[model samples]
Target: MNKKQILTGFLAVTIFAACQQGTANQDKAKDGKSISAGAKVPAAPDAAILTFEKESYDFGKIKQGEKVHYDFKFRNTGKTPLIISNATATCGCTIPEIPKAPVKPGDEGIIKVVFNSTGKMGIQDKVITVTSNANPEINEVHLKGEVTEP
Candidate 1:
């Protein structure tokens, strides 16, 4: 094999060996309690989760320069309160408004997305991404429609 390929193979083997050694060390504890080899680590409690009622909205058709909005409803289905760090859109024409307060577990929240069709035409799709402390921390909502000439 070429020198570069040989080097790559050696690097891969070295990384694999290192990872195996790390896993083997996880079976032992300094306090004399031995963890079972097959034991799995438990996940953290009360991770936030977002359950959306609907992820997309279709406005059908609208004239150019018209503005429309939709509220994306969601619930905090996990054990903890949902805190949204930020919500942003794919473009300036689409603005997203997220909740300022934390959504408690089992409580609902809304993410409002307003889309402006100014200077836009044809089939348009706008996306708003929500970032929060929720598990799988990022979620997206979409607004799509046809913008007809005025």
Candidate 2:
């Protein structure tokens, strides 16, 4: 190839490599949290942890059309405050209530789950998914029971 052509290709390759290097450097800060373009990134957490007393509950046998409720207790076992962002249930028959306020470090909280057996029968298993600022980010609690015809 001609000298000009070779020199041009070399310059192009150099520019491309430099651009890639800059992009990779900006992808994350020194602490490893990703940095977004023109948007504020969330700060690294200080080890907010959530610990549950029990991950599952059994209501045993209940009559159809009856409702059952249980409280899933938890504690913030880390150095930072624990904030529950949301709580979701597997089905409409199960409803979960998560505290709106943050649970401070070493503090305790409760998540209440109510299962409606109005039209349900036989063995029923429901799940509640809790989202928080904890390390794992999500947690699951289960509710199981047998509903007999009234």
Candidate 3:
């Protein structure tokens, strides 16, 4: 073939190769394969529901240097299991514990919070954020109490 024809043929082959590569990449994505670049993969079946009996708790009042406990009950209102991934307190003095097992639909669970008033005084407001598979994915629970001087 002439030089022009040769160049045109090479161009066609290059374009074809690029198109094939793109199709392959799309196929990989469809097959749940990660590309070379590190990107966040979406979780499978991305919807859930969680219902809480009470979002906030009032401890009323407690003496300084004392520890108090509270339980925040919730229900799995969604079709799938409710998995609480983690729970975090607003301050070090406040600790929270959550169930690791999945709560089935229509089942009940509890998030227990403990507030330590050691060295802490006056009115206090704390928060615990619970992360889960529930739709909206995060739940906030509040605690408030007045700490009397020991």
Candidate 4:
């Protein structure tokens, strides 16, 4: 083959291989085939899957200076244990608590959020971000309500 023809063929093969590289690290499909890159795949059997029963919470109308709290329930639906590494809030008025222990598969847990309406008034929306080893990595929950004077 001519050098020019061989170079073109090599370049084409290289491009094709490069395009196929990212999919190798992707998860498998239900049919036990590897899913293509950028395609959604089911959670790995050995990976943790976090499932939230409620992603948002509404505290209704709460009086200023009152402390409101809710338990955001979740379950580990994957085959592996779920570990919540961190839980944070958007502001100091809100606090979130996550368990230190790993949540085994099929086990349930709660993310406790305490909202302090001390200086807050009117319509308020606060967010709590939970980081875990579960599929998708991070999850968000909300606390919303109107704060009125007592």
Best by TM-score: 2
Among all windows of 10 consecutive residues in model 2, the one with the lowest summed lDDT is 36-45
> Which residue pairs in candidate 2 have backbone atoms (N, alpha carbon, C) closer than 3 angstroms, thus clashing?
none
The C-alpha lDDT values of all candidates are 0.89, 0.89, 0.86, 0.90
The alpha-carbon root-mean-square deviation between model 4 and the true structure, to one decimal in Å, is: 6.5
Ranking by lDDT: 4, 2, 1, 3
| Per-model TM-score on C-alpha atoms | 0.71, 0.72, 0.70, 0.70
Runs in model 3 lying further than 4 Å from the true structure? 1-46
By lDDT, the better pick of 1 and 3 is 1
RMSD per candidate (Å) reads 6.6, 6.7, 8.4, 6.5
> How well is each residue in 13-127 modelled by candidate 4, as lDDT tens digits?
9998977876556777789887765776655658998899998888899899999989999999988999999999999999999998999999999999899999888999998
CA displacement after TM-score superposition, residue 82 of candidate 3 (Å): 0.4
Residue lDDT tens for model 2, 1-150: 999999999999999998987777666657787785565445457767889999989999999999999999999988888899999998999999999999999999999999999999899989899988887788898999999999
lDDT tens readout by residue for model 3, 1-150: 899999999999999999887666643355777564344345556355778899988888889999989999999878888899999998999999999899998899999999999998898989899999888688898999899987
| Candidate 2 Cα deviation (angstroms), residue 62 | 0.4
